[model samples]
Target chain A: LAKTTQPISMDSYEGQEVNITCSHNNIATNDYITWYQQFPSQGPRFIIQGYKTKVTNEVASLFIPADRKSSTLSLPRVSLSDTAVYYCLLNAGNNRKLIWGLGTSLAVNP
Target chain B: EAGVAQSPRYKIIEKRQSVAFWCNPISGHATLYWYQQILGQGPKLLIQFQNNGVVDDSQLPKDRFSAERLKGVDSTLKIQPAKLEDSAVYLCASSPGTSGSPDTQYFGPGTRLTVL
Candidate 1:
């Protein structure tokens, strides 16, 4: 498994674009970048995933640079409901055991 | 589709007591996982099972924590003589067996446990 580094907290106003970046310098050849959002009392929900370049879904967009050392999650026109802890996950072999770290806490203020 | 389900939504016990939590994975999901999430931290995988057999339990504290999945349907996680640090949310998740990566897991609402 690869080690990841992300900011501890971020703040944004309503209707603004927010981008959360995660650095994974040790990403493996087959590792995939995935993001999950966790509310205060709920389990995590999938946001977006990508292997390279950019991948977009209805919920969010994931952008992985060509180097694959880092990735960014872009949320457009955020609202208070989008406030949550965002986790970046990678399955760098290791029998699919995910390395979950303390994620970035995003607070979307009204 | 129905998501993973966990019982007892909440549990409160004193130190050195025992507690148990149950989980029912999504129908037809062959892989089930148990996770512990401390306040302000991400979830830690405790155990993973493929059907009724254990797949990975390296992180499980065998001395006090035990989990079982019978008949490949539902599962139970037990903590004996619990400690104060055991107070956290217990989460259950399931993923399609054929998904291969097991990276995209569907999580339950989670069972909150507070040990005094």
Candidate 2:
């Protein structure tokens, strides 16, 4: 499993775009970057996933550079409901055990 | 479509007591997973099951923890002689297929266990 590091927390206001970056410098070539959102007392929900370059869904977008050492999860037009802990996982494809980091808590303010 | 379902939303038992958690996955899902989440921490994988077979359980404490996915539909995680460290939320998740499919896992509300 590839280890990931992200900021401890972030704060943003409604209608603003929030970007959280994760670093996995030793990421393997076969690794895939996936992001999940977790609310208090609820299970984590999938946001977006990507192997490289960029991937976008109805909910969020994932950006990966050529080096693939890091990735960023971009959320558009955030709202108070978007406040939650976000996790970035690496090598989710091959590793049965999806090692999760502490995650970056995003607090969307009014 | 119905999502994953878990039973006994909460449980409180004394140390050395045994407890069990149940889960029902969505129809047609082939992969099931059990995770333990400690407070303020990300969930840790306890076991992974493909159909009725075990795919991965390296993180599971076989001596005290056991899980089974019967008929590949429902699963049960049991902890015998539970310890204080066993107090945590047991989450059940299921995906459409294998991890290679990039299948998003649907999770249940989880069973919160409190061992005193």
Candidate 3:
């Protein structure tokens, strides 16, 4: 299992773009990067995932560098409702387990 | 499609007491997971079940925490002699059981457990 590190918290104004980056120095060969967002008192919801280069969806976009040592989650046009804790995880071989970290708590201000 | 369903959205219990939480995964989902999330922290995976069979439970406190997914559908997580440190939200999630790669999981509202 690879350990991930992310900023404790971040602040952004409404309509601004927010990027939360996570670093996993010990990532495995088959590891995939996945991100999740959680609001207060709610379960974490999937955001985006990528192995390398970039992956985009209607909700968010995930960018991974060539080294695969770091990944970034970009949220465009943030709103107050977008305030939540974002987690970056590594799905190792067989995808049986997901190692979680403290995650980045993003506060979107209006 | 109905999402994962969890019963008793909130539970308050005293230390040394026992409590149980129930979960119903999405229809056709073959994998179920139990996660514990403390305040201001990320969720910790406690156990994983693949169609009524335990796939991983290394993080589960077997002495106090127990979970079962019977009949490959609904599941229950029980805690015996709960402690103050056990206070957290228990989240249940399910995936479509894909091999060789990670599958997208759908989560429920979660059960908030307060141990005093």
For candidate 1 chain A, the 10 contiguous residues with the lowest summed lDDT are: A91-100
For each candidate, give its TM-score against the true structure. Answer: 0.96, 0.96, 0.97
CAPRI docking class of candidate 1: medium
* DockQ (Cα-based) for each candidate: 0.57, 0.64, 0.73
Residue-level lDDT tens digits of model 1 in B1-116: 78899998999999999999999999998889999999988999999998898989999999999999999989999999899999999999987767545356889999999999
lDDT of 2 at A45: 88
lDDT per model, in order?
A: 0.91, 0.90, 0.91
Report the poorest 10 consecutive residues by lDDT, candidate 3 chain B: B97-106
Encode model 2's per-residue lDDT on A1-110: one tens digit a residue: 56999999999999999999999998877778889899998988888889989999998999999999999999999999999999998755634667898999999999
Tens-digit lDDT track for model 3 on A4-59?
99999999999999999999999988888989998998898988888999999998
Q: Which predicted model would earn the best DockQ?
A: 3
- Residue pairs in steric clash, candidate 3? none
lDDT of 2 at A90: 77
Question: What is residue A74's positional error in candidate 3, in angstroms?
Answer: 0.8
Better of 2 and 3 by DockQ: 3
- List candidate 3 stretches off by more than 4 Å: none
TM-score of 2: 0.96
Show model 1 residue runs off by greater than 4 Å.
A92-95, B99-103
DockQ of model 2 vs. true complex: 0.64
